[model samples]
Target chain A: MARIVVEVMPKPEILDPQGKAVAGALPRLGFTEFAAVRQGKRFELEVEGEANEEVLDQARKAASEVLSNPVIEDVVSVHWARES
Target chain B: MARIVVEVMPKPEILDPQGKAVAGALPRLGFTEFAAVRQGKRFELEVEGEANEEVLDQARKAASEVLSNPVIEDVVSVHWARES
Candidate 1:
């Protein structure tokens, strides 16, 4: 079965407290010369059955509905890679 | 400047409560036959200076620091996509 990966993250214009917190930890982590850091989500799902349009459609719907928060985030892109 | 995109996600064996919550909403959203969903992150950073070893090194450091949490997550890959 092919693995479908989804990435969910806040839009550039949005304020990400989680990312901000992580950014704050950079100095402590020994990182310098960096400005901003944004955070988001990555999902890996195994699509059972044939990778047909119906399955893909259902997967996309599920992603928008349950997998990601579209209100505060955008750029929900899905990629397919071989599982090997 | 190139956009370095990083995708962070919980390990496959790990339980993703957030993804579970989203997967639970699938049927209501018209999705069926979907079993589980795991979630993670995507960061698009405009890397300054020449995209050389130094820039890449610093960028990777920043990613591990402020952009992603390596504790509960892994697969922190950074892809350099031309910004066009």
Candidate 2:
């Protein structure tokens, strides 16, 4: 089976409270090098066959239409897991 | 500034209800090519400087210790955003 990986991130203009919370907590935990944190979603879709162009196209459609909310999140990347 | 990307996924043996819900929804939405779906987290950590080896190392540490719960989640990947 092939796996397609999809990544979604909050839009730059959007305020991500969960990300903010993590950023705040990081310093307290002594990870002071990070200036900011943005948390988002990742998805792995397993298919019966290879992750060919057709499968990738379907994965992209699913990513934008079902996985991510276009109002606040952007579908950052979508590709075969092996490519990553 | 440079950004480090960290990915976390539920352990294989763990039950991922959220992922299961998404998988179930896909066929109903006509995206039936997928056999399974796994949901995970993507984190972008912004740093003041370039994402060099040291920064990536620190990001890896933070990913494991602070970003994910070792009991149920696994830090799947940690790398420079540019590389992705």
Return the DockQ of model 2: 0.87
Which stretches in model 2 have alpha-carbon errors above 4 Å? none
Q: What is the lDDT of residue A15 in candidate 1?
A: 94
lDDT of 2 at A77: 97
Give the clashing pairs for model 1: A40-B41, A41-B40, A41-B41, A42-B40, A42-B41
Candidate 2 per-residue C-alpha lDDT over B1-84 given as tens digits, one digit per residue, 9 for 90 to 100: 789899999999999999999999999999989999999999999996665788788999999999999999999999888844
Q: Return the TM-scores of chain A for each candidate in numbered order.
A: 0.81, 0.93
Q: Give one digit per residue, the lDDT tens place, for model 2 in A1-84.
A: 789999999999999999999999999998888999999999999986666799899999999999999999999999889844
- State the TM-score of candidate 1 restricted to chain B: 0.78
Error of 1 at A41 (Å): 1.3
| lDDT of residue B58 for candidate 2 | 90
Off by over 4 Å in 1: B62-71, B82-84
Model 2 RMSD, rounded to 1 decimal:
1.7
